[model samples]
Each structure stands twice: as structure tokens, then as C-alpha cells.
Target: MIDEVVMLRHGRTQYNLQHRLQGQIDVPLDIVGQWQADQSGYALASRFYWAKVNRLATHPESIAQPPAAAAERTDINQYCEAPAAARRMVVISSDLFRAQQTAHAFADLLGLEVTCDARLRERSFGQWEGLTREQIKAIDAEAYASWKRHTGGETRYGVESRAQVGERGAKAVRELIQDPRYADDETSTTMMLVGHGSWITATIANLLELDPDGMNALGGMRNACWCRLKVRHTINGQPADRPLFELEEYNKAPAIADSADWENGPADLRGSSMPDWCPIIW
Candidate 1:
């Protein structure tokens, strides 16, 4: 069974910077987004010893040399002593460019390949895809109001229902948990899913067997942020009862900011690009 599931939202993109709705558009990460992914990759490499091994394994000399070479090497040695069986790690990502770029950062650092899945893609906004919330309201007042109220199953241009997104997200989780390619007897296996904000939120809600609208109360997650959930499995490491998720962490960044930075919290540059039209609160 998978011991831990890490959900990472893709980093900033041009659309993200412009307050535009990205939906299923294949947008690449911008300069800041690239840096964010790199920093997040390094952080993950530090947290998971197996990922560290993968990071260091790229340099054969580092593996052969003694631990005294450098402080970083010393840190690597501290975690590399685990048995070979304990190092299993995998990265899965949405097929969207932003998500793929984020996954590639982790994959490059961890010396692993990325497995793309369509189910991990962001929920399509349909005709509302590129419009700002204000634009949507100006263009189709009824649809915009319906979405805000969560009362209608369809949007102005047939926007995806929350239930549809939840089902797709839930199916992806089920596939990962039950598919032999992802899960095994090894207890140390860690799976990382690189996806969009709405999709990740829905996936977590589904894993916990929450109702269709259950995630509304959780608020939006930030770009380049991640969350963790422990997976429960059968004795032999197979998929177990529903309620597969036990939340460990949610919407966390690698580093915490100083309290001084909170005086103008919403104005923080890191998330300043967030648009009011964007459903994500972060």
C-alpha cells in the first residue's frame, strides 16, 4: 500500500499571474513558477530520504566518496543508509503543461520519470474558461450567480459540475491505490500527485468520502503548495475500506514566513497575482 500521498499544486503561470481562468489550457510555468518548483523539489528531496538518494544517485562519485566531502553530502549520507527495499518513490502528474512542469522538477531532482494522467487535470470551466469572474458576470450574469451559489448543475457554457470533478479525482486516487504499477507490499512507497488547485482539493475530499460540495469549506490552496495524507491499506498492503485518507498536512509551503509579513497578508507578492475571479482563495 502507499504509505503517504503528497498532493502538490502546479506553480505560477502566465494565466495565474494575469488572474485569468486557466481551466484545461496547457499553460507553462512562468519564471517565478519555475523557481517555486525548483525550491519545492529541493525541499521534497530533503524530506524524503529516498528522494534524497535519488537526487544524489545521479552523481556516482558522491555515492562512492566518504561523507566528509561536504555538508550536503554529509546530510545525504545520514539518510542513504536505509535498505534498498525502502526507497520506492514515484511521481504522477496531470497532463497539463503547468502540472507537468512542476512534476518534472521533482522528477529531475529525484532521478525519476513522470507518469501523466488526464484524470488529474483541472476542472474545465467550459465557456467560462478564459474570462475573469467580472467578465463572466458581465457576459452571463445568471451562470456566474449560479456558480457562486452552487445551485445549478451547469454553468453558462456548460461548466463542469462539482460532482463530475469529484468523481474523476476520486477515480484517479482509486486507480493509484489499487493498480499494481503504483502500490505494492513495500511500506515505504511514497506517491506524489502534481495537479491543479481545484483538482487537488476535490481529490482529497473524495478520498475522505466527503459529499460533492464538502470541499467548499476548505478554501483554496496556494500555487506550489502541498498537502499530505496517510493511506490505510489491508494487512497485505492492498486497498482497504473507504476513508482511505487521514489528513496529515494541508496547504503548506516549504518555509514559514515571519509574522511581520502578515501585516499585509493578502498583499504578499507571493500570492498577489491571485484574481478575485479565481475560485482559489490562496
Candidate 2:
């Protein structure tokens, strides 16, 4: 099985700018979003390089470690380094246009191709597909209340349940992880999935074996941000039956100068108006 999987959220879209629910809409990336995708590509490329640098820095047989502990982890903060993992990675994306576009940028940078999968798509919001937060609150008060309460067996305007979306996303990822194409003796090969914030959130919770109620507990990834997960195939003396997706990091935006405000708005809105938080990536 692959050792690590990086789950990245798609870049910003017009809907995002309007603070609307995109759902499964095939919206294209905005100008700022495109720039974010490019920057994220470079950032993703640098990760492989930084990992190698860290290995070299930590080795007793290699050059002496840097004097500062903070400097020891091979900083590529400048974002000009070439990708070290140019090969040995399987890049996959949600079939939605935004995710595909974001995945393309990173895949092109790493000399790989994007494989599209519908299972990785964002949760469907049915009639609420492109509605803004205010619109949803005013028009569908009851649905909004149900959503906030996280009640099951009921969906607003036939929207897909978080549980349903998470299960689908989790199943797709688990199958991909078990694929033999990415396995290697080095055990450092990676799987990268570019997807929507809601879908990624649900997927992560599912991968961690959490129930539906815990789906959004960790929150969603911000536009162009990612979370790293580590999984093991075998444990103790037997093949692991139920593997654990250990979260290494969450909601990291390497390309952003300030990511403190890059949080999913609608998820936290909870039947209320949009918050004052805004993405500062641009």
C-alpha cells in the first residue's frame, strides 16, 4: 500500500467569491484561483525535495546539521526548487472542473497526468447548488436548521447527505490506496487527490473510521490547501484488516503568505450569515 496520501482542495471559484454553495457545479477557477493553483503546484513539488533534504540533513554520515533547529528541516520557502518526486506518484482529481483544473497544475509540475474520478466530487446540494449563505437562510430556514443540527435521514431539497458523500469518497480512496500500480520497494511513493472542501472533509473523517456525526469535526480544507495522511497495510503479525489513516498535517497552504483565515465558511455558518473571515491568499 502507498505510505502517504495528500488530499488537496480545489482553488477558488466564482461561487467561492460570492460565498455560495457550489455543490457539484462544474465551475471554473477564477484568476486568483488559477494563480493559487500554479503556486500550489510549485509548493507540492517542493515537498518531495524538502523531504530528501531533511533525510540528508539528519544522517550521521552526511554533512553536519544546521545550527538552528528551525533551519534543519530544509526550507524551500522561496518556492523555486525543482520537484524531487517527478515520478512514482499517482495524481487523481474529482471530475468537477475546479478540482480537475487544480490537479492539472500540480500534475503538470510533477510530470504526471490527472486521473478524474466522480467519487471524489463535492457533496450535491440539490436545489441549493449555487445559493449564497444569506439566500439559503432566508429561503430554507427549516433545511438550514436541520443541516446545523446534523440530523440524519433528512436532506434539504434532496441534497446528498454528508454520510453518503463520505462513504463514497472513502471507498474510492481505499481502492486507490490498495492499487498495485503505486506500490514500490522505496515505500515513499505518494497519492495525491485534488477535490472539493466538503468532499475532502468527509473523506478524511471516513478514512479515520469516524461515523457520520464526526464527518466535519476536523473541518474542511481551504482552497488550494491540503492534508497529509499516513496509512500502514500491515501491523503486528497480520495484514491490517482495518487500516488507520493517521493525519500528519491538516489545512496547510504552503503557497499562501497567510493562511490563518483560509477556513470553509458554509460549513461553519450553521444556519447563520457568513462570517467576516476572508481568504488572504491573493
lDDT of 1 by residue, 1-282 (tens): 677889999987878766678899889987667767776777776676566564354344555455566555434544445454345777899999899999988777656779999889999988878777778778877766777777763455867777678789888887886779877775467889999988887778767777656544456778788999987765456645642568899987766323322212233345655443234331
Model 2, 23-106: lDDT tens digits are 988999876677677678788877754444433333324433456755455444322233432235678899999999999888
Instruction: List runs of model 2 lying over 4 Å from the truth.
Output: 49-87, 152-154, 181-188, 212-216, 259-282
For residue 195, model 2's alpha carbon misses the true position, in angstroms, by 0.5
> Residue 69 of candidate 2: its Cα lDDT?
52
Per-model C-alpha RMSD: 5.3, 9.9
Q: Locate the minimum summed-lDDT window of 10 residues in model 1.
A: 257-266
User: Which parts of model 1 are misplaced by more than 4 Å?
Assistant: 54-85, 153-156, 212-216, 235-243, 256-282
